[model samples]
Target: MSKANTAQFFESVKAHGFVRRSAVYRWMWTNYDDLSELLKEARPSWIVIARELNGIGLRDARGRDLASDNIRRVWLRVSRDLEKERQAARAQQRPAEPATSAREEPKRFNPSRLPANYRPDVEIKPQPSVPATSGPYQVPASIDVSEVPEFYTRKDGTVVHRTQEQRERIAQQRAGFEKETRHIDRYILTQKAK
Candidate 1:
């Protein structure tokens, strides 16, 4: 690439927000036509191209100089991109054809082919609410005793059992929480009534 081309490549790279590796790909794509002509004339090796790229201060994504393998990989990608562009251009140049009866019809979804267990029409019923517990502990009916663990771990890295005193303290806290929630619920109900 020439000095002006290098300047233009950097400018394009900044404008497109391309990464270091992608910037090289973009540069290759932009100069593909000229590069193709040069390739046809000189047929230079990948090692020569790598050397030229390094000479021009063009580096890979890692900011290291390009190797023969790196150049070969980038060249392959550029060639593929150019071929795709050519194919697209050719496609655009060709006239569109009308749909014919000879063309196969698109497949339709068959609901009957679904598994026997599939029940799309079935209505999802809401679960029945558990009755509120009236015991001194005043534990929420939603909580299952079987699910609660017997032992608990503290932040200080100590394993402790749910002692009678700990249980009483927990029950007291739950009672206070229930009282506050009840007050809030009553206030909300009064506001809704208004």
Candidate 2:
């Protein structure tokens, strides 16, 4: 339909208060052309259209009196349906075309066209292979490392070692930790008793 006819049809839909998804909408679809012509001849407001619809025993899909909002929503839905129908018709009228050329062939790898820096005379050398061990490994009897130092010297020539006082403090902390762990174990076994 042309823009003018579409506008007329929408106006008629608004003026007639056709309910969406109801028997009235189906009826309107069937008599669209006649309604368009009638709308063009007489442009009525929503209130007048509602009164006429009520007089003719016409109501909305929910059996209630049609309001302006309901009529506007119906018009919107009808317009969308019309646009979709027009688009579908246009698509059907056009012919489909292929996207790619039928004469083109797939490309293959060409090694002869190597980079300028590539030298075919240079031979590639094989790397040395180490034997693979499969079973669980056995530990060495002993690892001798007497030459290894117990403490490392700093850049200022001072050895980093624990003092006598620090060693005594660490031993006391370890003893206290062991005592606390034993007490916790006993408490747990006795159901948290002191």
Q: What's the TM-score of each model vs. the native?
A: 0.42, 0.36
Put down candidate 2 lDDT per residue, 1-194, tens digits, no spaces.
Answer: 99999999999988666444675555556666775676678976666766766677767777988776665566556667767988999999988656766866877757778787776786899987644534223112242223334444457854433353367689999999999999989889899454
Clashing residue pairs, backbone N/CA/C < 3 A, model 2: none
Cα lDDT tens digits, model 1, 1-194, are: 99999999999988866453465687888899898898899999989988988898888887988889878888888899789989999999998866765587877968889898887887899999767666534445465544667545567854445674498799999999999999999999999999
lDDT of each: 0.79, 0.65
RMSD after Cα superposition, model 2: 17.6
> Which number leads on TM-score?
1
- CA RMSD per model (angstroms): 21.7, 17.6
Off by over 4 Å in 1: 1-14, 17-21, 101-194
